[model samples]
Target: MTTEIIDHEEVHAFTIRKEIEIAAPIEIAFEAILDELGADAQMPDGKSLSMKIEPWPGGRWFRDLGNNAGHLWGHVQVIKPPTLLEITGPMPMSYPAVNHVQYRLKANGNETFLTFAHRAMGLIQPEHRDGMPEGWTQWINQIRERAEQKARG
Candidate 1:
């Protein structure tokens, strides 16, 4: 048996940032985010992912597969309700990588502005790196719809 090594000159790292305006109160928008990212999370194709988030410092963000099995997405690093949430861990990646995710909400009268960022580095595959931007956009759009629907009712 022989050992083989691969050398890379460029580091694999990326940051995705998105800002969305929601036609709802900050509190409502924040709740929408929590709901969307948690049990209500869906793929871009609208299928449930069965995700769960514990919204506090040191809590977990993961997917529940049942039968005492699950995928650990991340841990909550900081949480300030209706304002900010930060998590750090490897999300949905089975390879060597570190990820950080943040959600921030700001209120402007009856409108809410949400800023989201997901940063990761190390051995990221092309599919994940390429798909994240579009996935995040769809998720954000879902959150907006949920919030606006709540506001309308």
Candidate 2:
């Protein structure tokens, strides 16, 4: 499971990579990321945010808003179950901006080493770009917590 995110380094002006080691198996970690939240999925504050992933190359990872109006977060560019997953064309960015996200996992003893990277190019919105790393850190943390908890169950 080897891959890298390429970019320059001025914060939002380049690619961002965040890594976390979780106390869970790679499979658990991977599943935690790919599992679809049912239609009623919502943010912690109750805002609608449906999420699902098909977990296969060329599969879709998206948020399904009601009435079929949903955001195409990205397409699974590559998937080597429990090890690597790459997605391209994510949203929260429109035309003139494109994003690529990758999640790499490696089993270590009984846990998993997870690496997440997001690369964006084009006219990135200042606010969006500014919050990306932090946003992704929070997102990855939440998923890590879930994976660890599931492992203990």
Candidate 3:
């Protein structure tokens, strides 16, 4: 339920990592995380975003934020299903550069630990770092909520 921005040695890249203890088992948590990759997943803000995912290495991943915003597009470079997913693409803000995102999951008894790391070299301008923390915080919270709900069921 907390988010912290870690300061790395690279000035051009920023990393945000969050961990949550969900009430669900590892399998349920894993499935919930994977479901979030779909276009119809419900966002934390109660908004439904359309997602298109090929779910394989070198496959494409996209989200429809609606309103003709085009698609937040990226390529899935790694997919270890129920464990890891790596994507390289532009942020929702349509930044002209591509960043890398890695999601790692581990099971601890009845709880599942999830880690998300985003690395954007030179794409996250100095001024943008301040806002990046909050943006990632929200995303992580959403993931935690969804996984917990699925586990409860």
Candidate 4:
């Protein structure tokens, strides 16, 4: 059987949100995200891309090269450690795009509820646009695992 392909009507902005409840405290969960995004989100080569987050408002988040020569991933628009973090910029995208992502966490007794939103506006390619939903879910699960492990030890 042949597969049906969807046709694009126009270029549009896309927004995606994902959430997970980690069996760890808010601090642990938040740190897990920071660590994961900067290092643990794996690539095809069994290794993760390098990243550096400034961790404060007006700070920057980007690929970290040893000699400070790297691409700018985004800038920290808002930051409230263990609670919220927001970024805005071009991200890792090559196209002319605007990207924003937010990480929010809330403490419920011992466990922490983590949520994030990723929004991209530009001429998004079909391949890049289609894969995000599942990709982000996997990334979140990985972060959750790291947080839980940190909490345990």
What is the lDDT of every predicted structure here?
0.93, 0.78, 0.73, 0.85
User: Model 4, poorest ten-residue lDDT window?
Assistant: 39-48
Best by lDDT: 1
lDDT of 4 by residue, 1-153 (tens): 899885654666999998889999999999998887676657545576777777888988888767858888899998888899899998777777888999899999889998889999887777777887877887788889999999999
Instruction: Kindly report the root-mean-square deviation of model 3 from the true structure over all alpha carbons.
Output: 8.9
The true-versus-predicted C-alpha distance at residue 99 of model 3, in Å, is 0.8
TM-score of each model, paired residue for residue: 0.93, 0.83, 0.76, 0.86
lDDT of 3 by residue, 1-153 (tens): 999996663436667666666666777776766677775465557687788778889887777557765576688888886788898887554555668888888888888888888777664565667777786777667678787887677
- Residue 119's lDDT within candidate 4 is 98
The sequence of per-residue lDDT tens digits that candidate 1 reaches over residues 81-150 is 9899899999999888999989999999999999999999989998999999998899899999999999
Ranking by lDDT: 1, 4, 2, 3
Worst 10 residues of 3 by lDDT: 6-15
**Native-to-model Cα distance after best TM-score fit, residue 123 in candidate 4, in Å:** 1.2
Residue 7, model 3: Cα distance from true site in angstroms: 27
TM-score of candidate 2 on Cα atoms, chains taken together: 0.83
Stretches of candidate 2 above 4 Å error?
Answer: 1-13, 36-48
Q: Which candidate leads in TM-score?
A: 1
RMSD of each: 1.6, 8.7, 8.9, 6.8
How many residue pairs clash in each candidate at the backbone level?
0, 0, 2, 0
